[model samples]
Target: MSILSLQGVVAGYGSAPILNGLDLALDEGDIGVIVGPNGAGKSTTLKAVFGLLAVSDGCILLRGEDIANRPTESHAGRGLAFVPQEHNVFRTLSVQENLDMGAYVRRGERAALLDRVFEIFPPLKAKRAQPAGELSGGQRQMVAVGRALMSDPSVLLLDEPTAGLSPLYMSELFDRVVAVNRTGVTVALVEQNARQALGIATRGFVLAGGRMRFTGTGAELLADPDVARSFLGG
Candidate 1:
């Protein structure tokens, strides 16, 4: 069964709807990448699923349960984790402390999860005591991702995880995203770097005008002439 799915999800800020009947799904071990033009509702889709935005229509399913419009605070207990593009980490907090905060919803120990995050991002382990703000952009992104991983979520949602970074760092962060997926957590991410993002996607979605225009394997979307000409910067 698909671990996470959105069916005709309509959501937006107040009166203006950004996602118009968006449909998406991800199975276990799938790396689902969403790519689109500006205002295509890519980031809003993540927000809708994580309860950051209210769903005015349709349903969001987590393992077959309809969770549309569920309270954001309750999403964590349902095994959903989201990492936004900016200001995701507490600048004043040490790296380890930020990670610990992600575990606030949990009841038991988090050592193993912390170790796994460190394993995925070795740089975080070395800088465990440093304030998140002191790190470079790429390192701070790592910390944000590491913090979300502390929740041991069934599905991970990321919005523009590679925004504003050197090419080398962007590549490295994608590698880390793949590492996170390999550990059996389903991942759904919206990315501005369409070409590179789709290259690693198990499932690729192309959004335009707040709806899915195309859905296929990453390779398929990359090879499609229309997708290339329209959205992939032909």
Candidate 2:
């Protein structure tokens, strides 16, 4: 089952378009990774789905409901969570506090949600009272992802979850993403690290110039000559 779908979605900044007729989908329990060059609108696709930009024309369906142009809360209420690459956590707040914020939409069930987040990110449980900003880069990323998981979202959208971290950290972060998927949350990853991203993705969509150049299983994309040469750094 597809948890999220974007059909002919068009969105951009003022007076300029970034995602042009972008089409994609994320099936339940599938880790879908989107990759391309710097200007390929990878982040924009996530932003559009999160309702951060104006989607001029197209339909964004969340579990078969039209979510295009819906306010952020509407998306959040339906168990859709977004964890952007930067500033994903509340720096001034402790790990527990940040996790608390992710469940703002879910009233009267806070205890269970907090416990669930800690289960997914064990480091967060140990440093529950420590400020999020003081953590190492990799740990902070864990907190960011943990916060998103607190919301009980079935679909999690991540933008460059391993942008600046070292190779070891990057590997660890992707490991967590796989763990999250194992627990049944569909993941949509927007990443610039094409080779690494495709390696773990069940389905890969290679975007170029705001359009999808290739959409196939991860192994298929890895084996394709054009995808390897153009985006996979062959």
lDDT (Cα, tens digit) per residue for candidate 1, span 116-190: 999999999999999999999999999999999899888999999999999999999999999999998889999
- Which parts of model 1 have CA positions greater than 4 angstroms off? none
Over the stretch 1-234, how does candidate 2's per-residue lDDT look in tens digits? 578999999999997999999999888889999999999999999999999998999999999998988998787779899998887888999988888888787757789878777777888899999999999899999988987887788899999999899999999888889989888899999988778888899999998889999999988998999888988778
User: Which residue segments of model 2 deviate by more than 4 Å?
Assistant: none
**Residue 187 displacement in candidate 1 (angstroms):** 0.4
lDDT, candidate 1, at 65: 94
Model 2 steric clash total: 0
Which candidate number would show the highest TM-score if scored against the true structure?
1
RMSD of 2: 1.2
